[model samples]
Target: MSPSVAFGTDIDERTKAAEQSSTDVLTAPDVPWNLVIWNDPVNLMSYVSYVFQSYFGYSESKAHKLMMEVHKKGRSIVAHGSKEQVEQHAVAMHGFGLWATVEKAASGNETPGKGGRQRG
Candidate 1:
């Protein structure tokens, strides 16, 4: 009679642990990100305000306020969201001929809508 060889019994347990760890990583919540608009000499202030209004559906006054912030402060965090969302906003701003960039919210110098309606 041939002897039966026993394989390692912990293989399935190890696999399940590995899978749970990977799942935890995959399901982790996205970190907040900011969409920053930079002041550029090319785009007129009115155009920047217009873009803010039309694209983000901001009120005229709010748009103007943010535009002024960009003009005076040299930059403004126009919106906040997940990294992917902010990246999309950056692409749209680029399409509008605006200088825009995304950064982790924690690293940003200012928060979006410091005293106004938060746009996310």
Candidate 2:
């Protein structure tokens, strides 16, 4: 096969792949955000920590840290990712008696991994 023919074939394949990638990106919905629970007067610190563990499965230390942030700082990014996900988290937080709300994560900071309370 001619060198030009081989190179042209590769270019065509690359272009097609790029087009597919662009399409996927364009069609993808923005990931739902998170509902962060702020510290409140009603819930005990330990109870908040327990809720984090029981509901979010965060480790004890991690849950404690977040709880402290809420207690001391008054708020923290307790949960994260897609709007729907955050809404669900907010509802769950409410059920647990923690205040929560959904918001878009800042740009250039995608891919929030798991960070919930510890398992039994």
Candidate 3:
């Protein structure tokens, strides 16, 4: 008797089901991800803008806008892509001495904006 008969299951059918499950996992829907840059006291605004431009190859205007967002808001979504991509971007940002994180894009609003502060 076959092992399937011993286990009271159709071995071929079970194998097919397992294969389908594996295929489903491989072809699963794509979920967006974001690279969030957080504000810190150490870096100057010009340096942050330059990092954004040099690292992302963003234009001066765009880099300035993002830097301002980081200053006015507590954090900014600097990049968006697959989980691995965003994670890499966050790591690159950290390498540039910036605080950064990677998180799911569509799950919720991760941005926390604090009113702009006057630093004397």
Candidate 4:
């Protein structure tokens, strides 16, 4: 005796196929990655702003904006590019004592340290 599992009986074939494939869904577009900096108590706000200005060569005002976003928003995107470029930015942020990581962009183009502007 066994419970029934039918093809067209509400248990769709697509669900079964998805279960078989242990891969991510393909909704992600051809978007560049992002460098994200999470706020931490260790790094002073001034130093964080300075890091953005020094490493990314952002202007003083632009750096302050990104730093404020990271401070108030908990996290802010610091760079945008391919996965490799974003990862390098993350590593550099780590060197500056800021918590950082890289991930696929949520939107198409959103850069933090670069003043929320996308660079080609």
Global Cα RMSD, each model: 17.7, 17.0, 17.8, 17.1
Can you write out model 3's per-residue Cα lDDT over 1-120, one digit (the tens) per residue?
011112225645633443333233223355377678988988999999987665554557767877998888878986655676666566667767899998788664542223111110
What TM-score would you give candidate 2 relative to the actual structure?
0.62
Q: Write the per-residue lDDT of candidate 4 for residues 20-119, one digit (tens) a residue.
A: 2211111223436777899887799999988776566566787888899999999988666667656655665676678998888876456454434421
As for candidate 3, its clashing pairs are none
* Residue 48 Cα positional deviation in candidate 3, in Å, after optimal superposition: 0.5
Worst 10 residues of 2 by lDDT: 1-10
Q: Local distance difference test, per candidate?
A: 0.66, 0.58, 0.61, 0.62
TM-scores, all candidates, are 0.68, 0.62, 0.63, 0.66
What value does the lDDT take at residue 94 in candidate 2?
A: 74
Q: Identify the candidate with maximal lDDT.
A: 1
User: Whose TM-score is greatest here?
Assistant: 1
User: Number of clashes in every candidate structure?
Assistant: 0, 15, 0, 0
Candidate 2 lDDT tens digits, 1-120: 011212244655534443343233223466445456776788998898887665555567877888888788777776554454556557657766788877776764533223332222
| Candidates sorted on lDDT, descending | 1, 4, 3, 2
lDDT of 1 by residue, 32-60 (tens): 67788999888999999988776665667
Looking at candidate 3, the ten consecutive residues that score lowest on lDDT are 111-120
Off by over 4 Å in 2: 1-32, 108-120
Of 1 and 4, which scores higher on lDDT?
1
lDDT-better candidate, 1 vs 3: 1
